[model samples]
Target: MIRLMQHADIHSVFNIEQQVQSHPWSLKQFAEAVDSYQCTVIEQQGQLVGFCILQPVLDEANLLLMAVAPDQQGNGLGYQLLEHSIEQLPNQPVQIFLEVRESNTAAIRLYEKAGFHQIDVRKNYYPNPDGTREHAVIMVKACSDDFAALFSSP
Candidate 1:
């Protein structure tokens, strides 16, 4: 089941973030996002499987964070979470944007398959624990008539 994130889901979500992200969002950071952004979680058999965080402004929306438990990766949960979040946008957004770590090939493929295309790059954006830095690829998707149809059909 997918539902709005509640305070109680923070622990699980934070754990997944830590497991999947090299620079995980701290629990406090998650708290702030939960307080001000649109957050949702997907549960399977009472276990928190995945979650997505988004920020919408006017006709544009930004997907701030998305994660799936490490054990749950490759099962299509991330794609489902992303599409579900898009469907839950406060208003029908004409565009959605997000940045992905240049090294995260799986996520890049997922976003591309969802219709987002790389538009630009941010230099040395993500800090690595090993003192290295990674660039971020900015991706965008135009959610016009054909894109909106993704939600209405079936």
Candidate 2:
């Protein structure tokens, strides 16, 4: 089951973020998402599987952060969480945008399967573990007039 994040899940979410990514969002960042934007988490048998953070600005929505437990990759949980986020957008002709590490093929594939297209690239947009920066692929998708079509039973 997927649901909105709660105050108690912050610690677990943070731990997952740290373990799965070289550069993870801090507690403060997650806190801000929980307090400001619409953040959702996916749970299976009560275990956290994945989560996505979304920020709505005008007619567009920004996907800020998304992470899946390392052990849960290739299980389609990321797609579910992402689709859920898209489902939550208001019913209007909105555009969705997100950035993925240029080297993250799995993420790029998932985003492309979900209807997002690579719009541009951002140079040195993400921090690397070796104290360097890496480029990111900027992707966007134009939604139908009714956002619900994106989430129809599939």
User: Using TM-score as the measure, which candidate wins?
Assistant: 1
For residue 110, model 1's alpha carbon misses the true position, in angstroms, by 0.5
Residue-level lDDT tens digits of model 2 in 1-154: 9999987899889988998888788999998889888899999889987889988887688988899999998999999999988897654436889999999999999999999999899999999889999999999988875466656738
Candidate 2 Cα errors over 4 Å, as ranges: 90-93, 147-154
Give me the overall lDDT of model 2: 0.88
Tens-digit lDDT track of model 1 for 10-92? 99999999888877889998888888889999998999999999999777899999988888999998999899999987787
Query: Lowest-lDDT window of 10 residues in candidate 2?
Result: 144-153
Where does model 1 exceed 4 Å of error? Answer: 146-154
Instruction: Provide the lDDT at 33 for model 2.
Output: 85
**C-alpha-based local distance difference test score of model 1:** 0.91
